[model samples]
Target: MNSPLPPLEAPTQSAMPEAMNPSPDRVYIGFDLGGTKMMAAVFDAEFNILSRRRRKTRGNEGQKAGLERIGETIDLALEEAKVTHDRLAAIGVGCPGPLDLDKGIIFDAPNLGWKNVAIREFLEKRYNSPARIANDVDAGVYGEYSFGAGKGARCVLGVFPGTGIGGGCVYEGKIIRGTKSSCMEIGHVQVLRDGPRCGCGLRGCVEGVASRLAISAAAAAAVYRGQAPKLAALVGTDLKEIRSSALAEAIKEGDTVIEEIIKDACKHIGVAVGAVIHLLSPDVIVLGGGLVEAMPKLFVGEVKDAARKNVMDTYRDTFKVVAAKLGDDATALGAAAWAVASLQPA
Candidate 1:
């Protein structure tokens, strides 16, 4: 199989031609829709962010509010960039899913409190521009493949640990949307049966053990049980204050209890990643999101060791585990790349 293209640098203003005489390929807008926030960016063909805006999703306000938020963010971005609708080629959205990608309808996203929302139609109607929507993680993987760490790799797997765990994959320059779009739900993969219940109602899933939510919950439990001294002090009688970051800090301070918790969390993540490596044999596994950022040494080191130990010898040396290069902007850039790719002849 051919290797993937090299990661493109984020385009700068100088990279975009100053002459704004709307070419056939004009600016593309990318939207990353998350449960709490929505980010919109306008990018030229070279993937330079001309303007970007972010707003709260206000999910409790429901779908109407979310759509309005998305529209408002896009409008703000366009206004900031002084770009008109006529100058836009298309809009690409990276949204939470269990979606009908072909139909552009989001089936359900627990974080967004959305169900069966026609996102593409909403964007097209509001912006009067062609629009496309995809799973946010999928967009992240595509973004990484096009302009981040996964560039030049034959297969790339993106693992993100935020409020929840999520993953996306790219194989041979294409996003791998498996049958029914059920492919790459890495967070839900079971690492240990009967260990702990996840939001998805599964026991011992990766999300249950390795996500930020999980880590925070574990910290709270430890504080409640009087097992973590630093966490208890930081919480100061408020268990809710024992968050993932505080726990990570405690580990950095060499707190034995926090170290044990970190080890356990890393072990679960490692096992889940090991399974993914053995199953997909991706050229690179890119890790990102809040948990990894908070505890880079723990997540990266443990996952790499577990994956190497678990995989067969023939495949052991072929895969590399690395950090996601794009950080938070990955999904947005991916949306822009998706728009660009869609416009090209299939």
Candidate 2:
């Protein structure tokens, strides 16, 4: 996900301290590109936030427009930080995949309706800095490992269940990656022989069975059958509005149908976590994203219990599953750290 920079054309000690600015400048930028939104952040060498900008993805506007918005957001962030391209050391992006990381090309991002985007090249050319791309969840977990809940853990497995279930693993200090792309597509790991269709167009993947989309689909069916009166009264069959907090509200209202839907979703997730435990034997499994943020105890407790039951006796007590702690800043910080470390000196 990185290319050699053209070399630092100019280095100024006034804007960038000598030690921290060896490669170019002390400033680093990180961009988090999600299905629904894109965000950019500027950070000092110590990872202090200088500025941040966020905007809707507008992906339906197509690839060209989407890229334009991303660039604009980055410029806005840098401007607000009172920094310019001259101060930039490197840039990193957290994007959806399966991607060709070596070429910085996104193979496909179903949520963004994108294909084969040369993201790293675009950023490097525009900002004149070395740039790297990483899977969004991979970046998130790395952030946590570096500064949040998974800090100090030698092996960390992250499962972030939102619109879909995204998984990541950081072993030792490295975010596991294939030669061409980031590895650990845990979401696509088969959980059911025949189940829901996934975003990736596969059948019975853990994502299709355990994600927010799956929960929403179940809630919709319940509302249609008049089995979830509280949920119906709250969101009125609008799946978009049935986000994590809404589901929590429904559960608090004691809606049996909604509760069942949630339980089923958790069961699938637990199964997947159990499998990951046996395969990776991570020191910690960090459960994150919108759903876990909304109902941390319910989601984490359920998944942990089921996963424990599924694992072999010797492995059952090995890893602890916990919630993510870094919130919105995790991906950005992780990306910046990855970029700064991966990029070469001038």
Candidate 3:
């Protein structure tokens, strides 16, 4: 059950600034925006990170403060790299959705506490450079496809199971931008009808079942009831300290309770991924994010089996599920790719 939000206004496309010329000597800047932290990097055409900076997002201070921090991070990265704006080819940003890609406007990002903020506009003004905005997962897919594991794949699906379950797809070489940029909201896809409530108020969403938040919540409940011994021992009195890695570690140690929880979560994730395989039949499926990276044996293998079991035999035999190669830098590198692609004339 997807929550209903007010209609978002279309983004206004700004003409590409003349300064965004193709120059091998120029550097590009990329920013990855999150609820708690923001990271910026300066890179050359070859994708070498010349400099990087990070800052607390300060999302509670509202959109203005978040944007300010993002600007500061970009500035600091450029300053550290000793590059002037003239040497910058473009700036790319990867942020949480739902976004209006055409207008470079973000409609609503629950994690960032932003609604209808013109992020690209703000970035362009702040840095005096041509800027482009994309959903974080989409940017990551682009990053991987352009330079990482999914390179040369005809169709690639990137799934990240983090604080929330989010995904993005690249069909052939282009990012799949659905109607109003709503394509690939994989997290909100309903896996169970009338099931667990999601942060977006939806029931039985993929994220509601398989996200780190959901897993952590379940762990907390189990701890409250004294169901998990090893996990409790590892985290002490605070259930909040029991992260996905800790849970994975407990499962690795063969703790029955933690194993069961992980199995349940994996089943949900597998089912959801199975749906993706059935529908898209992508050539490559990249599973990433903190949980998948930490518990590869558990999460990745389980999802592969579940998808193979549930998907059509023809599709199952054709698609390959693998871990993302870029890991945490996917967003940043993808943003750089977006900037390069967007700035180049078609």
Candidate 4:
């Protein structure tokens, strides 16, 4: 569970000892492969970012093309860093879907229409370096534990609400996971029986009720009902236009109904966190993703209060809820750090 990289003050940089630095021939690659976009970053031994390349995922192009694009992105990132292929030491990837951890295969990425993709094998064969794969949420949580909001905590449970909700835990500096697959599927936890149907075809899952997509749907309905005039003027009833920033803006413009919808969603998230507290006894709970980043104060405050109210009184004071600091870079950084840790001699 030991981390190879030293603790970092996220969004900032500090010099590391010369003895700790890797030789010129050693470098690392970290890739965040998201549904809509993908990013590849090259890092020095100390985990300082050397260069980056980004591009649209265009997942509809199919898995073969997508994997090729991933390879191309990494090549460009290394090119920008002025590092040769022979200098690469390891590669790390954060991907969405149900993954076979041992085999490093993505069983399914619904958003990408990809199934049974051997991402690890591809990276290893293409670059001739060790490659590690992790669920995107797990990588993000580990990133926070290593360098961001969850720093100094014994256990950190990270919850991110975007198009859907995702949860991951880092304990004693390692991601808490099953032997062959990822765990901590907090979003799928049933909260309200017979409520909304989730994308997973489950009823009353927290994601169906509390995710940004859910919130946007509700906000769009409100706009149609003339219940959120401020929001209607900003984005109308178009779900695609109702982004996190737009929702925050609607609330800022005196849209009480919109605020109420967000508050309700946070309450649902808090309810889930309360259950997690009883199970894991984590010392810190981190709220991250687009929605939380857009409204940190409201998400933190509401979820904190609701969580405290739901947990047993003895558990109420045991944890603190905080907003994530790393933003979009969390998954990539965590994946890179994980690769470094995994590569160390036993």
For each candidate, what is the lDDT? 0.80, 0.85, 0.82, 0.90
Residue pairs with backbone overlap in model 4: none
lDDT of 3 by residue, 1-346 (tens): 8888978987555554644756777898988998788899999868899998988888889998778878888889989999887788788889886888867899998877789999888877766678888888999998988888798899999888888888899887888987667478788888899998898899999899888888887877787788877777778436568776788777766567777776787788778878887787888888888887888777777888877887777877887778888877889999888877876768
> Candidate 3: where are CA atoms >4 Å away?
1-19, 224-227
Give residue 52's lDDT in candidate 3 (0 to 100): 89
User: Comparing candidate 2 with candidate 4, which one achieves the higher lDDT?
Assistant: 4
Candidate 2, which ten residues in sequence have the lowest lDDT sum?
A: 12-21
Ranking by lDDT: 4, 2, 3, 1
Best candidate, lDDT: 4
The deviation in Å at residue 172 for candidate 3 is 0.8
Give per-residue lDDT, candidate 4, residue 119.
91
TM-score to true structure, per model:
0.88, 0.88, 0.90, 0.91
lDDT of 1 by residue, 219-307 (tens): 77776777777777766435456566787777776667777766777677777777877777898988888767777777778888877
Per-residue lDDT over 1-346 for candidate 4, one digit per residue giving the tens place of the 0 to 100 score: 8767886756422121112225665788899999999999998877888998999999999999999999999999999999998778778899999899756799999999999999988888888777889999999998899889999799999999998899999988788999888999999988898988899899999999999999999999999999999999999999999999999999999999999999999999989999999998899999999999899999999999999988998999999999999988899989988877766765
Residue pairs that clash (backbone atoms under 3 angstroms), model 2: none
Instruction: List candidate 4 segments past 4 Å from native.
Output: 1-25
Cα RMSD (angstroms) for every candidate in the order listed: 8.3, 6.2, 7.5, 8.2
